[model samples]
Target: MTDVVSYPKGDLRRMLSVLAALESMPEATLVKLVAKTGLDKKTVSNLIIQAGEQAGVQISKSGPIYKLENWGPVIKRSGAKMALTGALNAPIVLA
Candidate 1:
């Protein structure tokens, strides 16, 4: 079985960046997210889907545009933005 605990820190940061971008940008597309997060197209796409499914964020797409519908039950907008903005300032450890 794959080890969830061994997920890379870079990936975590990338995921957070993607979520942060969506939180800040109302009309974000895959391309915009990639540019904002410094991640590639495929990586952004995968992370966006992962964010929607695991992070409890509702993301809807119309044509080529993506929108953040609402902050779902699992994660809050301010909290995520805070973490991304270095308010937490602590290493993230997954156990």
Candidate 2:
């Protein structure tokens, strides 16, 4: 996905990083997202919102845990994982 699009950099990259992290686990908390992406709480929070609104990623929150139900409009689950894998030059893991 990202290989086909050169636009996913900077904040977009960060958002993808967030998505990648979320995709790696069944559910994650804000602290876990911050830890996994090395992003602050606010940034992770905003990215999650952006992913849900703009990208159509279905992220359901239950208390502090966030679960990624759909990969959203930008890409599919496998594509997002592969894209982030290429972007980081490593596999994305949150657990």
Full-model lDDT for every candidate: 0.71, 0.73
lDDT of 1 at 63: 93
Q: Candidate 2's residue-wise lDDT over 21-48, tens digit each?
A: 8877776999888777777799889889
Residue 95 shift from truth in candidate 2, angstroms: 21
| Candidate closest to the true structure, highest lDDT | 2
Clashes of 2: 0
Clashing pairs in 1: none
* Candidate that would win on TM-score: 1
TM-score versus the correct structure, for each prediction: 0.75, 0.72
For candidate 2, which ten residues in a row score worst on lDDT?
1-10
Report the Cα lDDT for residue 21, model 2.
Answer: 80
- lDDT, model 2, position 77: 70
Enumerate residue pairs that collide in model 2. none
User: Once all C-alphas are superposed, what RMSD does model 1 give against the true structure?
Assistant: 7.3
